[model samples]
Target: MYHLSSLQTKAIAFLLTLFSAGHLSGQGLKNYGNNYRDFAGKAYYFGLSFGVNRSNYQIVHSRQFIGNESIKIAESNDGPGFTVGIITNMKIGDYFDLRMIPSFSFVERNISYTGYTNLEDNMTRIESTFFEVPFQVRYKSKPYKDVKLYVVSGLKYGFDISSKSRTKRLTDQIRLSPHDFSVEAGAGIQFFLPYVIFSPELKFTQGIGNVLIYRNDLQESTVLEKILSRAFTISFHFEG
Candidate 1:
């Protein structure tokens, strides 16, 4: 049998919690709209979304890290990001849909090494503009008047458009792969309006592949065995 990674499991749990809370809040809403009927018959719809994110790297230490003389602790620091995307949603059933969101995202990730060669702690910052596409399966609860609660699980592929790793040799900083794949999950609330359907969402993404481009000659790269990307995002989507 296939198993879920710890990150994937946590993402699922988070979404479930989100849905539970949102469902409760939705039930308390006294005013309801009949506008949902307009979208109920649509097979597909397109929309746009804007989001903000917090992103970081998940690092795994190598065996060599123990014996290393240059560094003691290597870890990552989280940074803020922004994203804009176009959403294409296809209805599959009364409560299910398939969705694709292709976005342009800007983020910065940092790595810090403690006790670096008897000097002060060293930090490396990597900035990226990612071309990200996520394909999602959405399960929405039956409408509660004008509001509906939904959860989505998906796989995303990302390529860093701002990466200079291809054009220049990286000697001072840790190098990363320009592209990666991730597993993601999220929750959202949809509100039917007169002109558009508005949805606000929370999402988590964890990379499946190691982004570290290991260089034996570099202590920064060698101190870590693997590097995975992770992000938490908040987005607002408008659909007609």
Candidate 2:
């Protein structure tokens, strides 16, 4: 069985509320014409984004875990993270755009288990600082005054820039792969301000590869057959 942590649950709830509020409020809003009337005529536009994220590992236990007497329970925990990125938008059509975002993120994933003696040794923490680039195709609805709704789907590639597993002793550390890839999908509402378009987006990402680096020396690594990345992000984008 799979379960989400409290943090993950709350984040999902918050995003759902945001979506509901935007959809409800939009019903009563009057059309303000095109907020960025002449803006789409340009070939490209640039923007900046800042966001908070929750990240974790999707752990699949090996047969070793089931057979071992020392291991009682195994689970993964999600934690808070932050991201900052530069966005480049290329207009493809009236309702479609190509977006590329190069971002840096701080993330952490934690693993916990219960031993026969209920000791503290059952916890392992992995930290990563990722440099990620995501390429997405965005589809937008017609603007209703200053508001527009959009959906985006894409692929992201990431490299862990702050991974210290190589420099550390294998005996004491849980090692992970430095590279990862994920499928991304999201939806957002764009609110045009006086001078900028402010967008609040909710994005979901699921890693496609097993990022776990198994080792014979580490019991934690041996117990896990695979670990995939999972994340939820709420981003605020400022575009011109």
Instruction: Give the number of the best model, judged by lDDT.
Output: 1
* Model 2: residues with Cα > 4 Å off, grouped in runs: 1-34, 165-171
lDDT of 1 by residue, 1-240 (tens): 012234545765776887777667766664556798777888998999999988888899999999987788888888889999999999998879999999999998889888845575888888899999999999887677788889988999999987776337546777898888999888888999988999988888889999889888888878789999998888999998
Q: Please, what is the whole-model Cα lDDT of each candidate in the order they appear?
A: 0.85, 0.81
| Candidate 1 lDDT score at position 49 | 96
**lDDT of model 2 at residue 129?**
90
Question: Least lDDT summed over 10 consecutive residues: which range in candidate 1?
Answer: 1-10
Instruction: List model 2 lDDT by residue over 102-135, tens digit each.
Output: 9999987788887888563467777779999999
Give the TM-scores of the predictions, in the order they appear: 0.88, 0.86
C-alpha positional error of residue 61 in candidate 1 after TM-score superposition, expressed in Å: 0.6
Clashing pairs in 2: 32-145
